[model samples]
Target: MAERDGGLLLFLTGAGISAESGIPTFRGPEGYWRVGSVNYRPQELATFQAFSRMPDVVWGWYLYRRGVCRHASPNAAHLAIVRAEERLGDRFHLVTQNVDGLHLRAGSSLARTYAIHGMIDFFRCARECTAETYPIPDALPLDWAKDRLPTPEERARLRCPRCGADGRPHVLFFDEYYDEPRFHCESAQRKALEASALVVVGTTGLTNLPMRIGAIAAQRRIPVHVVDLEPNPFVEFAEVTGGEFLRGPAGSLVPELVERLVG
Candidate 1:
């Protein structure tokens, strides 16, 4: 199957990559990006000003996200991607659109990984009064279904540890500039693509960025391989699967990919 692809190996993945660990991949209608359900607009919630003025609303969502991702341990499929890269070394690049940070926790390196939405790892002041995005205690997401955006007095209380200014989660929201494009994400993506192979996994191929990566691979003529449990509207280029890659809720298919590559 890889023979159809020229050579470079890159994995442009989305929520499906993390889905095996019980993480929800953003999908249509009920997906994370959908509107009209009290779901705050992506860009509005992710922005510094928004968080500064509505910390509870914004942080509440993030805290909820953290709760899910906190327990989203890496599975065999995730580790397989890691192991495949270890064998392939510089030849492989895993470019994921996920913010769960599971790739890193699975032991993919900072140099080896690329996240376009930014990770939920750090918090920065809304004013950005300081240069640092500080780390803080990971808190549980508060129930804000009944609560509206915080009032002015409420805003004053949620301050960043680095500069004492308001802060927000680091994930990229709708209408917001992608963290990678805003912060050298593309450059690293270019580097990842340059002379390397690509493997697209668990992506819907319906998204802008992940789909764009597919286009980029086609344009650059990089070798691309995709694996998924079901057919994806997002991809027509790679192999397809009808079975869940991750085993009966505990094991994973990524290890199978590793076996395929190794033996």
Candidate 2:
């Protein structure tokens, strides 16, 4: 059926897409980094508690990640998704787990894109004095060294404008739950319900919201397609839900699939 038939096509992306752009996946070896003299995993470091106890360490980790993202350019997969968005207009929607902001950089409209994981280059007040999100301070270096602590001047810059409280990275930490204001949890669920098909790329279905979107689509019995290099839960979502798992690298397969779907 043609997309003009009022069917919405939803595309969900993950770290795998950004991995093609040279950014490291969260579960990879790079996810393990040092905080001062101690080693910490992404799961351990990416939590409210960690940030509360040692905001400098957490900020250092994200700044290093931002540096990695800044060095990498959008890959074929990102551009392909942009092309799909251009062609489909409002009929297409993207829900990305990647915080690298590559999708926006590749020209995907922000209005049509949902970044449930949060943006890497933005921050908000940790004290919740205001809901306003702000861009990373220009004074702070984009790429911070591993295990480095913020200097006195850098720490001052990281303070919230509203309350002079410490500013937290806008990212959804491991311990945090999803919500409408930051993560667009409810809207994503509603969009999944409206979608005629769900295309999952490069994710293993480990996160809560993406998995929930997949489950919602599965319950609706709509077409669910998964593209990845190996078998994962998303592949199973496709197969069990009467869809197909297109096994291949996203840089090659995603463009081909988008072309076939929208051509």
- Write the residue-wise lDDT of candidate 1 on 91-175 in tens digits: 6677777888888999887777777776776555666575354443433233323223444554454567767766666566654
- What shift in Å separates residue 53 of candidate 1 from its native position after superposition? 5.0
TM-score of 1: 0.72
**After superposition on all CA atoms, how large is the RMSD of candidate 2?**
1.6
Per-prediction TM-score to the true structure, in the order listed: 0.72, 0.94
Q: For candidate 1, what is the lDDT? A: 0.60
- Model 2 earns a TM-score of 0.94
Model 2 lDDT per residue over 147-246, tens place: 6777878878878998999888999998998888888889989999999889999988888899999999888888898988888887767877788899
Give candidate 2's whole-model lDDT. 0.86
